[model samples]
Target chain A: MKWCTKDIILFNKEKEFVDTVVVPLVPISWDKNMTATVREGEHITILAREIEHQLMGRMVEAPPFTYLKSESMEERMKRLKLWEKNIKESGIGYIFYLTSDVDWNQKNHNMLDMIWLPAVPLEHMEGKARDAYLDETVQDILKVITESWQQFSE
Target chain B: MSNKEHDVTRRQFLNYTLTGVGGFMAAGMLMPMVRFAVDPLLQNKKTGKMVSVVSVDELTDQPQRKTFKVKKVDGWHEFEEQKIAYVFKKKNGDIMALSPICTHLGCTVNWNDPAYPNEYHCPCHGGRYTKTGINIPGTPPPAPLHVYDMKVKDGTVYLGDAHPRGGA
Candidate 1:
């Protein structure tokens, strides 16, 4: 029932502190030079679970999730199996990390504001095959994110 | 007023007005120059720049390192040739494109090195990109070499600027 300028602490059905999240928060996107910013006093009435779900959705939307590097022995093996099966599965791969000043899940005008995901077909053993996979992966990712947002809003 | 004083006043006023107008007109002419100087600040200069490689037919999927040039357009001027490298492929009768610029530091990368046959090596700073353009972090490159946007028509490949690796 109480609120602070920056974050709001929500009480659960049991009157226990369920979650404390920054207010007026925009999740990080996959664009460059994005800063995680918060206002001192902004509040919204929403379940902590909903926010967490949205946050995870945003994180899933971030880049590097769909990138499958075949150079790694493990990745190579995974791709080999996928290639053999010819079945498509989705996953995330992080090859490098950079220190960001913003919240890792903030959304901005461009996805780069939070994370830069370049989805490629992770199973292609060859270059063109990989490009086609990338094209498909991107299309699928966009669809998933769009559907998630619509479902969350509803 | 004395005749000489009157004449001097007239000339001085004319000189001041003429020079002032001339200066104003000159500055007006240089508006484009001013904009040129300050435009980069207001613009995101690093977005979606295309680096060209070879025609799609010249590059093969077997991983050959081919060096080429991209004719870049800068304002009203065009640079004849800017060096670039790429790997090209025909996958199931489809053309695909890749860049040889190391994702780490924009260095030209070599593929299928006899010494390090398993990896793509950058001799400049010992950075290594995988055959698929993944930057091995411990190496010099901070990221992967970019991939150029491309289209194939009649077997000729037209490339766009290098975009961030993965999918950007």
Candidate 2:
């Protein structure tokens, strides 16, 4: 389910059935890596949307967790842990943290399932190339997610 | 050599005019969308509106996902929302369209995923359905996927509401 009013109402009633959440962790860098930051954010947003589309009814996509590029890892994680705590408290058991930022993975890390992938530029492609890339990537992500579901249930 | 036959006499002109106008009026009355055209001043019943999604010839044995928009009236608000249906040609040479929403939890199901080839696979809870929309036993879906009310007009496939086969 999407993070929208209509889906929220459905999510409220059907929260028992939907136990998973996909959170796109996006980084913002204004002074440097501006273009790259935007590109990664765009890809993460689209990828998260496609993932939510494929996994709708079982998972609700939370709003992206955005933070500054220069922010300390401790500060960023402190903020993320709050989101994780609230989400888990709200009855969502599984949280898949989708990110193109490698920094999140390298960090000592919070409890969020940080799914880090190298930020690949999707801006140059069009038509079938873009869709093919997205499809292949989403398939791989879904595999990892389903595998996680198997183990995470316990 | 046939100038006399090509020429329209007064009687023939009146006969053609009446037939053409009468036929047009009759058609406007009988069609679903035209009930109001026939009698807008009387009571208006909500008719099942069918939207043209694709041509019948374009459908193949492999199911193709198609999206179409419908004007939905919700209380005082009337708005349009896009809907998706998987359309395919059956073995018996009939066009079939099924709703993609999984019956178990409303997630979109894909046709012929690598994990579940030749069947609709719902990645959410691993729901599986046969090619004909019947849910596989032991899967999460309790009933078969809903089938769209369809019509073929001038080789175009027009789909109405998807009616669920209530039996599990």
Candidate 3:
């Protein structure tokens, strides 16, 4: 019965796998002091290991509207490497999840979902869609997504 | 006068002894106050002075980072170059200035971050603001970035430490 339990889905949209990444989910190093939560929304932590796997093309889409904070490209990559190393050494699955009111599937929403990628370098995120995963200067886009999702749920 | 010749006057001895003791006590009491008053006047350092950070020609309609220095006096020494950060732009073709100092903690903010793209970033604390200097509440920063009050005379931009962000 325990083995029959469903694997927690990471993404809403399932794309054909580039490869079957069955590597055991490892826990990540998260600062207990650092946390964020929206009113009646999800609390999530994006780890460095997941970032590495995502960048390596092993994983598909990152969680919709993940927020990250970083300064430069080299530093971001270095953080990813460190996150990956932490996961490997700890043998504790690094990736974790939090469900939020914001739905990526919704047509148009007007609520901002903060996806904090604290370790990712800022310079690398420039002009990239992944930049949304970082602290957005203008959170209007994410706001729309969250609002839409909230309406859908109701 | 035969055994012990004593011509010393009592008045002279009393006067000499009292003057010596009085001078020592007076100096002891006055030392702390003298040092206290003189130290501040002597050691007072300039926090920062108003300086021209950008010129009209240098500032475009788009926000651009401009670096300048102000002489900060410390004690007897002078800080020849204290780096000050600002965002320069010409809104409606009129030159304007924005201070990069975050309203929350006074940390210098950078205008361009490849990570956040169009947001200004504070490294000391995770303070962030839009290009237009609006505060994003709930983050580490409590308020928006400050805009330096300025005037354009002929062509150059002059700045003062008048915090005008969100009426700060």
lDDT by residue (B73-108, candidate 2, tens digit) is 898999766577999999999999999889987888
Best-matching candidate per lDDT: 2
Ranking by DockQ: 2, 3, 1
Candidate 1 C-alpha lDDT tens digits along B1-168: 666644667678899999999999999989989999999788865434454445665766666654444565678897644334455564565555566665543435667767568577764345787766777768767777777677666656667766775541
* Candidate that scores best on DockQ: 2
Model 1 lDDT per residue over A16-133, tens place? 2121121221233343422221110011112111222322212211111222121343553354344323312222211112112232224232312122332222332565564344
Report the lDDT of model 1 for residue A94: 14
Whichever of 2 and 3 has more lDDT, that candidate is: 2
| Candidate 1 residue-wise lDDT at A20 | 17
Tell me the DockQ of each model, to 2 decimals. Answer: 0.01, 0.44, 0.02
The candidate with the higher TM-score, 2 or 3, is 2
Which order, best to worst by TM-score? 2, 3, 1
User: Residue B166 lDDT in model 2?
Assistant: 70
Which portions of model 1 show Cα errors greater than 4 Å?
A: A1-154, B1-58, B73-77, B90-94, B166-168
